[model samples]
Target: MAETILALEGATKRFGGVPAVRAMDLTVERGTITGFLGPNGAGKTTSLRMSLGIILPDEGRARLFGKAPNARTLDRVGFLPEERGIYKKMVAEDAVTFFGRLKGMPAGKARQRAGEMLERVGLGDARKKKIKEMSKGMAQKVQIAAALVHDPEFIILDEPFSGLDPVNQKVLESMIRAENQAGKTILFSTHVMEHAERLCDRIVLIAKGRKVFDGTVNEALGTVPRRVLIETGEGPDAAPVLAAHGAVTDDGMTGEGTHRYTLDLAPGSDAQDALKALVDAGVRLARFEPVRAHLHEAFVHLVESAEREPA
Candidate 1:
């Protein structure tokens, strides 16, 4: 069995009589990229802080590497907080090396590692430039390199892709993949569904300070109903036939000559059954394809379902 790298059992935190996170149970196994997903103010940062022992949890427990997080265990962890900061006067390479040294690397080795990391992150040319002279994306990449310079076994990144353009986001995604491929246990927090969808082997979703879902991408997708797009010939409308097989419209049908309709399948309802119904009814089908459920849809469904649960 794979070793559990991190575990939080009933971890809870509160501020001023209000809960920030409540009874959260999460476990990250070794060598897996786990995406901690939630919107802003959803307690992602707080939970991470607690896991790192930066703040004491109001209740329950958080363990890193099967023991309480502290200086010893933390040396094996690399963390990039949501807030980014670096010494304005410090050279990029120097800043990265400084952090590596703090993580217990020898000064000479830290400097060597920092140079290699900066080059790998596409900042080789800017290694001698002061951090204040770099662009926002460039500075962010420097911080990321600094976090990894010590070669920690585990990595935690909070909103690492935030404030990055699409191109830079893709760059960060590639970096994350490289780290995972290097056998590092990575846990990254993000509100963006696309990042988690494309990169994570598992995802844990929190909403309103409560854990709403936890599983693989496929399992998370299974939480929401599937959708199928159907386009029928003008001769016969397929909407009515589909509606009988679990098709629902948020708004009542309004458009005339509408040959295209999207059907949401309820639990246990299969797209094949809908197609068979359409064929048996002699509906002229122009197109039939199952629309795969996206991570965004699954996330929304989970949040909405949690919201609807009784207090």
Candidate 2:
């Protein structure tokens, strides 16, 4: 219910009948970091284009701050596309400053800000060198500076970590967190779920041009069945007996008198049934508890569910 910073209503795009995005609808609230995640070929780039006003949706609409993709709205947003570009011959500092000037920042002020940002991003030493002379990580730092130099209210980054090494990745992650804390809205698209898990306040997942899931990590994972790992007495393949009323993953005895079994909760499954099952299986049950799935497990469960849906 927070004020919407970006909204797409029934937005659709196509590359000659092969739909890139199909009737997708999503909203990003002001000052929130919302993640866009998907596997390869999931239409992440096309959705980003509509969000940034580069290409109008062939069907439906995209709005930024209640206005159609126009100069005013565009000026208020920073974009780092999946495919990045920088003048290879231009020094890193000059290139970023030039982009700021195009956005109406005065040249002198732009240069000052460029210098500050380079230092902040740890590329101050390479600021005077041509982009082609720098390593991929160094060049990427310059590109991020260019995207953020204008200090736009909303930032959209597409695959910003593709070329970054681990050290650079950590550096960029810190920068992103700092900016978010400063109250800038961010919509970052990545194939990497771990990044989203670490950085986003909320998440929107798309697959094959359709939305498969949208919400917080906790909310997304809430649908998975709660599980329990129990180590008890002894039983020879207790799966069928225990699973008769629920779901069972495995069963085995550890040490003497210690039996371990993985239980999958059935719909309306009574957990007490687990202890009873083990007790009746001639195993003296010793442990009982539910284990919640991790973020990776939840993500796999959701995506697998989405794959079963009809196109």
In order of listing, the candidates' clash counts read 0, 1
Report model 1's TM-score to 2 decimal places: 0.94
lDDT of 2 by residue, 169-253 (tens): 8888998999999989999999777788888889998888988888998886676777878665544556666676567766655
lDDT of 2: 0.85
Badly placed stretches (over 4 Å) of model 2 are 230-241, 251-260, 268-290
Per-residue lDDT tens digits for candidate 1, residues 96-207, read 9999989999999999999999998889999999999988988999999998999999999999997777988998899899989999999999999999999999999998
TM-score of each: 0.94, 0.89
In terms of lDDT, the best-performing candidate is 1
Tell me the lDDT of model 2 at 29: 97
Whole-model Cα lDDT per candidate? 0.90, 0.85
